[model samples]
Target chain A: MATELIKTRKLAVGYGPRGKVLQGIDFTIERGDFLGVMGPNGSGKTTLLKTLLGLLKPLSGTIETHAGGGGRPLFGYVPQRESLDTHYPLTALEVALMGRFGRIGMLRGPKKADYQLAHACLKQTGMDARANKPYRALSGGQKQRVLIARALASEPEILLLDEPTNGMDVSSEKAIMELLSELQKEKQTTVVFVTHLLHTIERYAHRVALITSDGSLIVGEKSKMLAPDVMARAYKEK
Target chain B: MIELIQVPFMRHILLAGVFVAAGLAPLSVYVVLRRIVFVGAAVAEVASAAVALAVLFQLAPFPIALALTVTSFLALSRLADSQRLPLESLIGMLYAGGAAASVLLITKAPRGEANILNILFGNILTVPATLLWAMAGVFGALLVFQYVAAKELLISAYDPDMGRTLGIPVRAWNMIFYGAMGVAVAIAIRAVGALLTFTMLVAPGASALCLTGRLNRAFLVALALGVVSAVGGVMLSYQFDLPTGSTIVGLLVVLFAISYGIGQLRSAA
Candidate 1:
């Protein structure tokens, strides 16, 4: 039986009490699920992602995240690339080392084992060659790879990415998706990503959750969710 | 310069300068990286206002300044996270308010203008032995905190959302960061005046960041440049009959220009 990592029922997510963006979101994210959240520009896809990660509060429902040993499940979150400031003079290795910071705990530094893991993750993401390079000096695709390496270094059970391929070229986007696909297949890492592109959901996601214009959600298998009638109705493009 | 160091007052000034630079320079790396330079400026301004308030109430300046600066730092940090207003706008309001309050509070104190000038431009020569010792203790603690919490602090500043997801109390860390910044600014303001303290907190970090691509190296280079600027400024001020605070700031600016040039050349190469 598939293990449920996150389950939300009758959830409403938004900025504040009156700022409801999405409502009645009921979904289950199982282990090893490649779930893609799709919607229009203002349809609250990112908001829902934030809600699931517990970064934002849900207006009226409960979000239960189940972990093996109880408590909140460990999440690896990759924020939008543009949201991060590049002015910081951190090397790529240093950026990846941040993933181990929580495990390293407070008032302590990263151990030798931590460095080895960070380096291994970077090498896994094909960013080992650029490990010593300044992060700001990297290309967009390379930076995204480094970010993925950072997330992977956390050894998270669930990986969440917000618009992971927002500004990438077709090849870079494909490469990143392929990498995520490989991780999911090999490690059974639960992956949830937010995107507005229907093609992305069709090509990559095993399951799809669509947010309509009126703040309602439709979630199902990718094959069913991508049906022409459902897509047309969800996007109000009929 | 040797003759100058022979004077007891000169020794006191140099020691005070070294302590202040050593503490503030390393913290400056975070301030610059986090892009909160104005927080340093506004905190220093508020600390000056606190000093003025101390003078008016016949209270000890250090404790009063520390209290006000830390409180103001925490408040500003909280407000900066709010989406209602731009962080820069809020910092500007605090800066203006603090500057106005300092001017108003000083007007009623005896030797008000001189005291105001001293607060604005520091009387390094007049620093007492007690204050020097206090600076050593305070700055020493700050250095140790920075060393131990280096990774946590960096993660908190660089990717707060990621930190939160990882169960790091980012808000609490932010509070600690601002509190440490408050303590540093308060003490440095007492030693070097508000303007010079602000300069020390920004210029060295900016220069070192320009010179080095690595964060650790930047911290070391910033510390070196800070000490050089402080020591050079003090000696030049004594030899040239210049204002010590202004001289330090001027030297730092010159060093920054040199560093920038070197960085640009290296990058071109």
Candidate 2:
């Protein structure tokens, strides 16, 4: 009884005319699904995530998203930590409050309930103690947690994260994965993430999509996708 | 200082300086935080060029300057996502082109050399009453816009991709932000000159961010620094018979240096 949230049919995505990275991609993301996108470097993993987020236009084909209320599905995106500039003097709480910006609408400020939600998200990510701390002063792991808090503060139906545990120690990575796991179970939130770490997919993802260097995609349940021969065939194309 | 303030013309100059500082200071916070300081210089230069063109054509300076600066800012906004060239490179091109155009166009006009000097160094002492009123009106409107849209502007500038995912219409917001900044720069050039306008956009924000290290407090600190530098620079200039625009820029640079040193010490401790 999986509820399909997003479906892509023969979708082609890339930068432009000369930058066709992936083609003939088909996938469906369902509610409460933990989906992992995996590939080698420059294999269109991030591009696919960007395409799903509507940050980039598809080169060809169509993406259809069905939300319960009949409007565009709300998304909470956690970009790579390095993509953000640390020069801003925003506190963690302030950064998290950005999630409420759209809901707060134009020409309006955050209200008391918005602040309460942001604080609650920060606490969920174990960052409540440092809510007032400068984001730049945080360590890599703490910064990642704050970013997760920011995403969660949006209260999105689908959470899309790009390399959430990138550049973290093993323990930090495990802790982040565990936190995400707990959130998925507790909230029944749909999760889609891009990762180069196979173990991350093998452990947490219900389904996995592998993008090869030849611009082909292989997607299936994690049990079949994580098989040694299947993984070897995908990596061999690189 | 009291004696200087008692004079009608001196009071007008002080009022003009305060208006320009108040308008540009809060914007300076965004300019510094977003690291688009060169964009400010480019806009100011383009506005100056427009002024030169208007003078050559016997047209009103402010309208033409506002139109051209706003147009140029909108054009430059397209480069934000360009992969072929960095935005800074394009902005640098605009800066150089504007500077050259101003010089070349001014040379063909009557009293062109004097006009060029005025645009560069500003003739703040002789600012007309009409221009003062315009500055007050425009800057007041800009202040209100900034206050109302502060949260949206901050989120859009800080993480545009995330903003996009949140359905923020980041590009449109950016265009509006740049457009407002263009209006401020255009008015500021008329009040203080191109060079001082650029300095006001960068220095106060940089100094305040360094000192406060908090976004909420940074705007107030930046405004205070801007007003202090403007008033201090004017007084020092009158006392020393120095150039007013240059004096203001110098004071801001000094303030920035002091703030940077203090910020370093605070971080170390």
Candidate 3:
């Protein structure tokens, strides 16, 4: 039996007053659920993710988290690899270590345990060999993997990703999906996978949410959501 | 070389240079990462405006300048997240407004233009002992704050979105970072003038970044570069009777150009 981790009730999210992109969003994510969020450009997929992560305020309604003593959940976010400036002077290990900052707290440096945990995260991501390599030096797939490791290093119960496979080749995308699948299977980590790729969602995601341009959603199991009619309905809702 | 330090005025200038270099150089690393290089200039402009205002009104310059710079920094920090207005426009607007305010205020005060010019182009040699002590005390506190909060500051700067998700109070941290910057700008303006203070905030860190891809090492290198430029520029100015602030700024510019050239070659090779 899966425990409910997060729920949204009649939710509305966007920028400020004039920037309402999505509204009336209602979804329940169980612990260890692989939620694939699909939407076209400007379809408010990222806005939904941001709202769920509590990075952006919902215009209305509510998103309740049950992760910590039935309070706000600690989230690990894997933003688009492109979101980071590659030119930044950081190593993969250093990047991974950043995840621990939340746990380690401020007013002090990282302890020995933090470094060990960061290395373990890097190793899990198959990046321990290149841990010392500068972040900018990594390939697209390697960067994505390191970013995932960074997120995992936080030891979050729920992980949210935005376009994790945006500019990758076929194998890289496949590798990332497989990694996510393994994490879900082994750790029962709740994952929110946001992307535009339909086939990947159909293959790896247990559930899929297709957001229409008009801020509506069609959500269900991948088999149901990825059907031809359902997909076409989602696409033609502009 | 020995004679330069023998004079009390020159000794005060060197100490002031040390304080500015030690304080601003380490802080510049974040400035480079945050890509708010010109925020220093904007803050300096506000400081200059405040100084002119103080002079015109017969009020205290340091306190007024610091207060105005800190206020501007707070405004900038709040505007940093606004999607409606680009940050550059706001900074540019502040820069223009401050410069114009300084000119306007100067026009109404006796011997104001000359005094304003002096504020704009600082005379490091004339730094008072009291101001030197003040620089040391304020900058020392700032350095400690930065040291204790280095990791948090780094995460907040490099990826603020991630910082927020990780429960880092990014806005508060940003305010702290900018507050330190305002204080640095306020202090350095008296020693190196507005233009050189801006240059110090940007150039050393930029040059260090070009030379290395390691963060801690980059910091040390930047600090070293800042000290070298500060001490070297002052010595050169003393020897050649050139403007001290401009000379230091010139050295930093030269170092940046050289580092960039070397970086390009390294990448190409």
- Interface RMSD in Å per candidate, to 1 decimal? 0.9, 0.8, 1.0
TM-score of predicted structure 1: 0.96
Cα deviation in Å at residue A236, candidate 1? 2.0
lDDT (10s digit) by residue, model 1, range A64-120: 878866767789888888888897888899999889988987888999999999999
Of candidates 3 and 1, the better by DockQ: 1
Question: For model 3, what is the alpha-carbon lDDT of residue A100?
Answer: 94
Predicted complex 1: CAPRI docking category: high
Winning model by DockQ: 2
Per candidate, the number of residue pairs that clash is: 0, 0, 0
Whole-model lDDT per candidate: 0.87, 0.88, 0.87
| lDDT per residue (tens digit) for residues B200-228 in model 2 | 99999999988996898998999999999
lDDT by residue for model 3 over B1-269, one digit each (tens)?
A: 68989987887888888789888987888888877888887777777788789989999888999899988988898888887998889999999999899888888877777767777777676788888898899877877887799888888788999999989999899888887788778888876677778888889899999999899888888989999999998899899998788898899999999999998998899
Alpha carbon lDDT of residue B6, candidate 1?
96
Q: What does TM-score give for chain A of every model?
A: 0.97, 0.97, 0.97
lDDT of 1 by residue, B1-269 (tens): 79878998888888988898999998888888877789777877787788788889988878988899889888876776675787778888889998899889888876656776777778787888888999999999998998888877887888888998888888888889888888888888887888888888999999999998888888899999999998999899999999877898899999999998998999899
